[model samples]
Target: MSEIRTYADNRQPLDRNWLHKQWRHLRLWRRFLLQAVVRETHYRAHFATTLLVGLVQLGLGIVPILLLFGFTQEVHGWSRAEVITLVGAYQIITGLMAAFVAPNLQRMTEYIAEGELDGVLLRPVSSQLYLTLRWINVAELSNVASGIAVLVIGLVQSGASPNVPQLLQAFVLAVCGLALLSTVWSAMSFLAFWLQSVNPIGFIYLNLVEAGRYPLVFFPVPVRAFLTFAFPVAFATTYPVQALAGDLGWTPVAGGIALSVVAVTLVRMLWRRGLRSYASASS
Candidate 1:
């Protein structure tokens, strides 16, 4: 009985410590996000230009789909509305990544290059959390807004209104998709530890992500399978859009969840190894 009580007591403190640590991270991230918003507001002209550019990009992106639909009623059994939904999902996911993930990874690379990362490493918080939460490009929210607008339009035009359960599943899948992208982004950014320039690598990743804008159905069976299983671009756009458009089924969703878990585990291991390789100038 005494041993049981002691074990229980010990577990309580560990659980409390974990919760406390999580709270601290949340507070820190909020502060950092607020700072980023304020900093962007100070650059009014730049923000305006970014907003304009994002809107223009959104408009231009729809052009190819429009042209394709004009030529044919459906591309690979995907009607015009379904394609729009996919595009909208792509925009939302990509816009969010630009708003959050890409900028942070780019900064991480810069920090690694300039040796400024030494200060970040010395901080009491998790270096990964700090690195990711330290920056934001508020102008990219314009893209987010544009994406939301496009998504609403697509959903209406599709006339395939998902029920509550399907909508929830789509949301969950979308989050998983973001996690997968972040995993890939982190793995690529880790390369900065060994290389002087990772822009070319980043470019490749960006283009690959861009490919997800079109329906995976357009690709050959082998290519589609590779994208779905190997790279997971299909999860990022196609699957989530399908979920919203109607039945996505459970198999793909389960696969995506499993992939996210495995990817995150691998990314953490790689990140730790990269940290060990880091030669901090401050040290």
Candidate 2:
């Protein structure tokens, strides 16, 4: 009877090939995402309240920009509408993080701290994918919707309607920029392996992102360079808007793609090293 139970509990090993393993992880992530959706759907009033709060936060973000423009036509050569477009782009990216990435990071930290990470590590898939894609904050969709609305209004008001190719280019760059930012978030969460608490570090990233709400022109040249190369603040918000507004050039676009690729590679290496350092509760 014990032998029969052991046989029943044992599962087949997964394919060892890289591509096959990745495909399996992809399917696993889809399942995790579906579970998250179902769980979120069960809390309707909570979802609604969260959505309303997100919208209110977005509204509050724009107020300072409006007040700044009231005192000047262009702050550092960025007109009111242009700055609005930047704000919308900022919201869209941050909203995406809040919906998909932030929740996972928070949960991952908990898993690490509580020594529940063994369950995640034992899965026959990429631990990074499982950790990052396990949860989705659907309520944050409100910020996404509001951001698109504001972005369209700003673009129309800016009097620059990008051609189809230009729009496509902007989208590709925006996605690359998002990838870069996700690496930053992943690296921040990796801190849990070493630090006992990382709540304050999470807030610091948000404050850094907040700086992207205005034109990069407002910042000093050194600070602008730091954002562009050392970090990716300009690529995340400014470059995408520049692409859509017909101001983007090829050189910076190439730079953003390169930065994203390098950042992602480094993040993967760091995550693996961190996992090795983790001592699970079961151990």
Candidate 3:
């Protein structure tokens, strides 16, 4: 009770000490990552298998794009190079999701269902942060490398040499996009609080992620609007590629950042609300 009260009271203030708190949290995260790495390294064959599967998946993802481009020069104003760039960006985002976000959220759903979260809630640290960062899928990192390679190929094919500012803009937008995706996953996983099964929900979310691989213009105006404002799938893949291709402006970047902030805040609140409804196994 005292530790919980101390944590709650500390949350009331955002001062210089907040940075120190965050630094501590970061150190904790580093330790967790290191431990996960050590555990992953113990299974060399499994790691190799995951790497092979990731490459196979990457190749499969690119095949349709190549086939489509062969039929037409462009799809809804997106050139072959731009489309490839979008796929590359989508690969990177999904790689991060698979590695860092999805595995944690999937486990979180199980934790909530099985009441394993009781242990996490008793910890002195932030439960949400701890839950999200406790595990690392180190083997999935190969997909990130594959995405980078694909992104470079797309850029080279496009013949666009992005400047430092463009690269920085793309990086920021990518981060924002990732933040949005993570929040969405968190929000969906939190549904385990009310629902008996969340696996289907998670499957639906993965299907939605596939939509991020294409140009937003390919969809209807309603979907384009939804992908931009409501769901913001385009922010993850399209906007970043646009930024990389020097086609994006400051407005979209600002919007992406703002939306990410709002999404994360809302999901954090949702997590707290979900916790209040959580019933432990003993209950």
Candidate 4:
């Protein structure tokens, strides 16, 4: 008979076959975030320049949203400030994707084409994690800051008195939604392992994500339904706006968190499956 075993602090036996330990992996990501902060400091001038340009574009993007309030009380069922929140949320997530996963994945594909992936695979840590964070666009931090400021301004302009819980609810949902969105991008990029010519596909996916610039409600029913269920983007773009706009109740708010967890799970599984075909020059 097989014997049961368990770790001291853990209630159940440690599943050794799991390949990656999620708790430890998550801690590492937190550490990586800190490392990114320190790294950002070294490139102050470049980061500042990038931030300036991004902020200019982001500020310009706010015009249409603010104008909607002047021309009409609401835009596509969302009031002005609610629309601002939507834009802010979309900007935050999009900037994160561009400044992190997109660059690295683009480079990864180039490296694979040039037979440079061997160096990545030879590292001591997991190749997946290493490949995912090969480069960081420090300027994107400005986008996060600007997004939060916009959200606050949105609440003030909308005359919404969001209590601590409401504020926390919005913040937490936005972060999780971004995580899941990035994971999905990473998962999609890992398809390069098989597809070999996935750069075009990546561009297409990026274009699809651009559609998130507006609230999902503005979309036709079929598009809204597909993005919500098929692409899981409605959680990323619309739910936070809904929470602030008072269109959706707590159910969709909770659903965003649940969707994030499921998204990360699916991405990791897909990544592992692709890893099987990993054959490097050195190997």
RMSD of 3: 3.6
lDDT of 3 by residue, 146-213 (tens): 89899999999988899998998899999998998888878888888899568888888898888898
**In model 1, where do residues sit more than 4 Å from their true spots?**
1-16
- lDDT digits (tens) for residues 1-283 of candidate 1: 3644344334334225878889988888888789888999799998999999888888888899999899999988898888888888888889888888888887766788788888887778889877765777878888878887888888899898898878877888888888898888888888888885676788888888877889888999999988876667888889888888776787778888999999989988888998899887555
Cα deviation at 273, candidate 3, in Å, is 0.9
lDDT of 3: 0.86
Give the distance in Å from residue 42's predicted Cα in candidate 1 to where it truly belongs: 0.5
Model 3: how far residue 30 lies from native, Å: 0.3
TM-score of each: 0.91, 0.91, 0.93, 0.79
Off by over 4 Å in 4: 1-42, 67-70, 281-283
The model with the greatest TM-score is 3
- Summarize candidate 2's per-residue lDDT along 1-283 as a digit string, tens digits: 3644454566666776778888877787778778877888899897899888888888899999899989999876688898888888988988888888988887766788887788877776677887877788877877888888889889888887999877877887788878888888788888888885667778878888888787778899999988777667788789889899887777777888889999999999998898888887567
Model 3, residue pairs in steric clash:
none
lDDT of 2 at 75: 73
lDDT of 4 by residue, 190-220 (tens): 7777767667877877878876777887788
- For model 2, what is the alpha-carbon lDDT of residue 137? 85
Give candidate 1's whole-model lDDT.
Answer: 0.83
Model 4 scores a C-alpha lDDT of 0.73
